[model samples]
Target: MHPSTPGSTDQHVLHSAAQWLSAGSPVWLATVVATYGSSPRPVGSLLAWSADFGMAGSLSGGCVEEDLIARLRAGQVDGGQPQLLLFGDNAAEQARYRLPCGGHLQILLQRLGKDDLAGIQQMLAWLSSRTPFVREVSLHASGQRLTLLQHDSPQTCRLTSEYFIQPFQPAYQLLIVGAGEVARHLAALAQPAGFAVTICDHREEFLQGFDAPGAELRCAMPDTLISQRFADSHSAIVALAHDPRLDDMAMLDAFDTRAFYIGAMGSLATSAKRRERLTGLGVSSTQLQRLHAPIGLDIGSKTPYEIALSVLAHLLAERPQRS
Candidate 1:
């Protein structure tokens, strides 16, 4: 897994916690409630620790995990109470946790026992189904108890004096309109970065030769697959077929979806031609603006792998910024 990539670590933590919880183990979940200065992990960052498995995620990018694990082992956080702990707030603490740039992290630790097992399993189900929901944890006035609630609504993650409300967005989905080298490379890079990748192409020969681990390959027309199977708010549709018959149709269909990112790979001249063709096919000028033709950041990429890296970089930059 790419440890520093956004959302990827949270997925890992959730999966690990599910496994441990299924085994009837009491797990402690630590969430980064607030951050001051240049914190390594963002708000809502998670780390799950079980007495048997140690730790499964990261709150800070340094020695903070070690110290937190020590506290858990020493029974400092085992009192069945939700504890709000501060780290790197002072010079000595900063030095001890090795927090870069003197960043400080406020974390909420909640101990989950057998009674919480069903809730954890339900969360895992929601994640597996790519459902959008919010998990709200409110601390009691006595500060010795916390309640977890799940609901569908406007997504948000905020920490107040007595509550922490974290929204869990569905995993980002990437639909590639070709099974070529660029698509394979892109899938390899994107999966580690927390994207659920799907490659759709009608060519049997291309499908036979394509091999990108963890990426689902669909032997169907790009437009058909896109219109029938893909396209959501958290989805990204990329056309890398380099053929108007395929790329144009895919982009046309993608324009109707709520996908945050829609791009097509080509040269500047080729992209202009594609746009003109799309316009001729009844696509509006305003809708055409959403199409990121000549996709990927301008990194002067030449090789297929370099082009893949460029595309991934652009996707990362275009990811929805947390509020």
Candidate 2:
């Protein structure tokens, strides 16, 4: 699967459920509702099970999933009503589940009825559309209910004794404004790290031999593509083209966007000259400050791959933290 594929692990479970449903099998979905201490999976991590396909996704590294599957097969969790199961509260239970550092987890298990299937299908649609949303599961005295709320930013999954809310956001994207060796290496590294990678270069020859799996290649002008395709907050724009004509133009366009990270690859002297040129072109001080020139960390990198690693390391540090 592409690293930037939407929904992450939760999406995997949903896809598995859809497949099992299509094959005329009943599916069970499990979500981590809450975690105390050092759980293997975060809140909202998912697992799916069907008699035909066995299981998909995971709730723990191994043992918790095994126990969940065993219990399902033994008819211990057969009721259609949603149930919350706790694991690793005691030393023996912790050893039984092999939870790391005695972590405790609360799991919400639900059988896929007709309505649940419809909801899963809807969630899949939203994920495919790259729409951000929140799935709220309420376990109240009245009954258990699931609701979807539209939102721009994904909220952290949280349990408040009555409700469990898990937010879903679109995948992160990286727009590389060059097809050079550094750009190629960076694209390869970013793709596996869950970035939707796109490489843009007007130089057709440079792009012709580029080989980064799962990255979209664009032969259009870098600046135009940056402005058109990467105006989102979750996007990062990096100019790795050695030519100032290309890199400067892309950086100018990037400054006008909400892209979280805007960077240019160059030496310190080259970056200083570029900054002067950009300032003369009417770029504000604040926007210029956002540009990561001499891009990448000060790792004393010389080779193309090493430079790519440094750039990726800096990007990871600059990325917004999610709860």
Candidate 3:
């Protein structure tokens, strides 16, 4: 049975699908085009399924994948047409699939041919470059098109009686400016939460042998890193170094970027002092308002892991369409 992980991004599934197609395996693309009530995954969630290669994405948290695969294997689904498959439309189906009470999922299931590999590659290129694009599909039949979206395009999916359109953006990024325990824990937590984590520290000593799986480790100046890259609207910058030398400089560069969350870890008094110092350094009051001093939700966290949890929660709260 193919497993479902709600954590995989759209790039991941598309990437895998492209790989499978290259290796001569036919892949099925399943997308959650619409949802109602208690859906486990969002409307834009994707699942790539191949009889020879299992699955590489998630449409629901549980039984939906197995059921869909069963239908696929039975030859009930064919490559000739794109169709909408609905789950949890009634009480019995909801209970059978263990869907949240009243939850419903409408998925667009399409069989991919080798000719579509180029489109998948293009989608991957767009995601890698942080470009936004839209994939529109006819819900009732085999028709599809891709459109490059404006930089300000809304990051969401829409479903109508005739079509489904989803705007695809790059993965969320988290640049944690520290190599300390809190940064390690946050990186470990953020990866599965779908943030591409980068841990930056200027001190080589702090970076020595530090490990957080899937996190990019950089022993570089944080300020230069922020201003040069990692400052887009999809990025969140958090300074956990606590050292004014490192954290304050990072903050200055962070303010100039379009980063959605700019935060620094500290106690209330420390944060107050930090604000005073920043204001003295010419950080306008308006810019200072965007800084989340004493970063994270007020969860009264004492340990590193707890603090990371609160920080992740706050980040999620600030994120759009988190559900």
Q: Pick the candidate with the highest TM-score.
A: 3
| lDDT (Cα atoms) of all candidates against the true structure | 0.81, 0.81, 0.85
> Which runs of model 1 end up more than 4 angstroms from their true locations?
1-8, 141-154
| Tens-digit per-residue lDDT, 206-323, candidate 2 | 9887888778999988766777668877789999998999999999999999988999999999999999999999999999999999999999999999999998998889876665
Candidates in order, TM-scores: namely 0.90, 0.88, 0.93
Model 2 clash pairs? none
RMSD of each: 3.6, 3.6, 3.3
Clash pairs for candidate 3? none
Error of 1 at 115 (Å): 1.0
Model 3 alpha-carbon drift over 4 Å, by segment:
1-8, 140-143, 151-155
Over the stretch 122-230, how does candidate 1's per-residue lDDT look in tens digits?
A: 6667667666666667665212222322453435667777777676777788999988999999999998787989999988888996799989998988776776656
* Candidate 2 ranges with C-alpha deviation above 4 Å: 1-8, 140-154
* Clash count in backbone of candidate 3: 0
Error of 2 at 75 (Å): 1.6
